[model samples]
Target chain A: MFKKVLVANRGEIAVRIIRACRDLGLKTAAVFSEADRQSLHAALADEGVCLAGFKPADTYLNMDKILRAARETGAQAIHPGYGYLAENEKFAARCREEGFVFIGPSPENIRLAGNKLMAREMAAAAGVPVIPGSARGVVSRDEALAIAAETGYPVMIKASAGGGGRGMRICSGPEELKEEFSIARAEAAAAFGNDTLYIERYLQNPRHIEFQILGDSSGRVVHLGDRECSVQRRYQKLLEEAPSPALDGVLREKMGAAALKVAQSMNYFNAGTVEFILDEKKNFYFMEINSRIQVEHPVTEMVTGIDLVKEQIRLSAGECLDYDFSSVPGRGWAIECRINAEDPENSFLPSPGTVERYRPPGGFGVRLDTHVYQGYSIPPYYDSLLAKLIAWGPDRKSAISVMSRALREFVIEPVKTTIPLHRRMLADKSFADGDYDTGFVRKFIPVDEDED
Target chain B: MAESPKRLEIRAPIAGVFYRRPSPEDPPYVEVGDTVKKKQVLCLLETMKVFQKIKSPADGKVVEIVARNEDPVADGGLLMVLETD
Candidate 1:
């Protein structure tokens, strides 16, 4: 275990990592932007270093500043949390070179998984069901068109360097493709500073499911379970549930096995997520792999009884997984709803303001993770997520019921939230019956309908 | 739905507890009847853990203080009332 750990990120995830470090008797340091000097994470950590300005490039994403902070604070390890430099292969390499432990997967594994194009090729080579499309970055329109014709219509163009719904576009035909390609390239360049794009067959109405894979320094890897992140808006996950309602015994085993293959192919270590898209007919195709602990990890933790953050730290320190892999199969069902500061009623616009009332959900089987309080100011310069509410039960129905009860008990005043939307979702028969898809939210929450 | 003076209320820029001064020992940023120029720091709004200095948007007199020091506020919630000349 590290004597001191530096969290190279901000917000709730940062808070989460720091708390775990504290529990393990390890001193923790937090790095923050000028805009987040008073954030909960900063207050909770043993110490905090201001990275730089409000923008990501100057602050949490500032590699040099983060490394300097770790060195100055005498931290033995750096936990990149989820975003910022979490999945950055170059940062991981730098940490290894500096002789500081980098929590999560190794740099070589990150090198293969950070770039979606490479990850896809690796998956294909591993005999995983990867989507058929471009073999590499499509530089020319002609190349994209060729790949599109070969893969069939409704192709998806994605950024090779980043994910989280920032740089992606879908085109149904050639005319639309030509019009969209430039915009997609521009968005990708602005967001990731790398306009490298790739093409893939766009599976319509697919269930966005991901397998949580855990690995140790001994090169042993195991799959926890699958999380269904199908409920989304603009590619941003709204809700995630583990032991995906769509997964049957046969399909679960197949997806879980394929996920382990992805990890083994890269010799992946620590915590990572291998995402897939399940088509309407239950056929699954490999999407990209997230090279860090995802926001939805709580759902997996709920059923598996594993503390992923602690596991990541332990594995990074050369410890083997302490349990029998075969005996640790996930049990029960878990669901997590992200309570963002954005208002669902207002087109999900970022709602940065003061939190007048802070009342989190409580009771059995309800877990609320947040770094906020009644007087906490919502910063405009970062992600809008305020907290996460996770619930677990013996079955999906019980989990939904528990989540509904938890959401009702939860209260954050003066700032509009998606709580009401969640309330509606839990009550809807389609959602309750697990018949909902990615389009379920949009179909249920129609903009033009008058709320009577 | 005709608007009223209450509708044009000034709000805090971010979410956090309202602070009257830069620090515990400092005087309050502004009080009712005080004249404020554009870009003048009105109060400190602390969010997450950052202390942000909320500045006046226009030259005006602080007519009413809707949110007190150390009180929690919502995004877009009225923080003060300003009367422009």
Candidate 2:
């Protein structure tokens, strides 16, 4: 086992990894950019290395600098704590080649899951249900109609080479498809220079559900439970909770088994997340596999009583899966709200400045993971997430109450945060009742009238 | 007595980390007491990995570099002072 570990990231995640390493009696080293000299992670670590630049490319994302820091500090292991180079297979491979334990999945596992199409194919091959869609681009209207008929109506016809909502049309019946299918082809050719089009069944107002899975070098894998992250803005999750309100025990077991099957198919080890989209009918389709630790991992941890970062380190060191999943059963419910340094009223623009005053909520069932303190100057060079506030309770209702109370108590001054938005979301009837889907957050945000 | 030279300030165009050189290994684009042409790149301000080149507004001799290399700077933060005839 390695005695020292280097955290190859910054912000709250780096702080989290350092704490986990410390708990395991391992020496901790932190790498930081010049802008993050005063960041809590750097000061909290036993040793720190300055990466000599402020931007991510010159600092956090520079694999060479991270490797050099690990080598110089004599850190036997490197933990890429999400974001930055966490999912970069080449970086993981380099660390392994240099004899440093990378605290995550193997490079091969990352490669298998990194490609979205490949991940979906692997999931399908492993008997996991994927979203129903055409296997190839449609060459004729008849082919499109046939596939749409098989997949059901309300299918989305999209250009093979277009993105950003371009060259896309949704048809609810054969008449609409007959009228728009050819129009979409011409539009695709004019816009993307490709007339190729594909069709996929569109699930209106789907809920985002993901399973947390852990595995070891011995190929044993077990899923913890599910987290519902449907509360999102612009595809970025703002709040997440464990024991998805929409899932019962039977559905949970079925989806958990499916998650395990997907992991086993890739021979995945360490910590990974299997994301799925659940339609209104409760049918879940495999979306993709996230090979790195996710931003919303705390909810799973709180409910399972498992330290994921610690588990990752142990698994990377070739330890066997020691946690008994059946005994845990993901007790209680947990909720996490990401607090970002952005103004909710001002279109969520970044608000980077000195945090003149800071007060965080505390009490029973509350956990906060953060690196900011009073007088801390937030750098403008990175993501605006300032902290993650998580609350646990015996049930979903109690968890929501605890979170609302905690949000009311927390305070940060002179710099805008998403706290106000969280407060509003917690109070919304639909959110409190867990009767909302991915489209829930859009109602809160006013439409940009100036946009064409 | 000769009039004092006309001093003009060059401010950062964006909020980011200021750098005197294009890259760490390269020499600084301009130093104090160095003559520079108009539109010559004086420094770089990088945020989110996008670099915005801060260029000289006019031909002049740089009298003082206000912003240090590798330090975070705000938009409109002074970077250098140029003395022109």
Each model's lDDT = 0.84, 0.88
Q: Candidate 2 lDDT, tens digit per residue, A1-452?
A: 89999999999999999999999999999999999999999999999999998778899999999999999999999999988998889999999999899999889988877655567678889999988988766899999999999999999887765532356688999999999999999888876667888887877879999999999999999888899999887567899999899998899899999999999989988999999999999999987788899999999999989999989998988889866568788889999999998777866666778889999999999999999999999888998899999999999999999999999999998888999999999999998888999999877766644231
Per-residue error for B26 in candidate 2, Å, reads 23
Report clash pairs, candidate 2. none
For model 1, the superposed segments whose C-alpha errors exceed 4 Å read: A186-190, A322-325, A446-452, B1-85
- What's the TM-score of each model vs. the native? 0.82, 0.80
In model 2, what is the error at residue A80, expressed in angstroms?
0.5
DockQ of each: 0.08, 0.25
Model 2: DockQ score: 0.25
Task: Write candidate 1's Cα lDDT for A37-154 as tens digits.
Answer: 8899999999988886766768888899999999999999999998789988899999999989999888888877878888998998999998888988899888888889999989
**Best candidate (score: TM-score):** 1
What is the interface root-mean-square deviation of candidate 1? 6.1
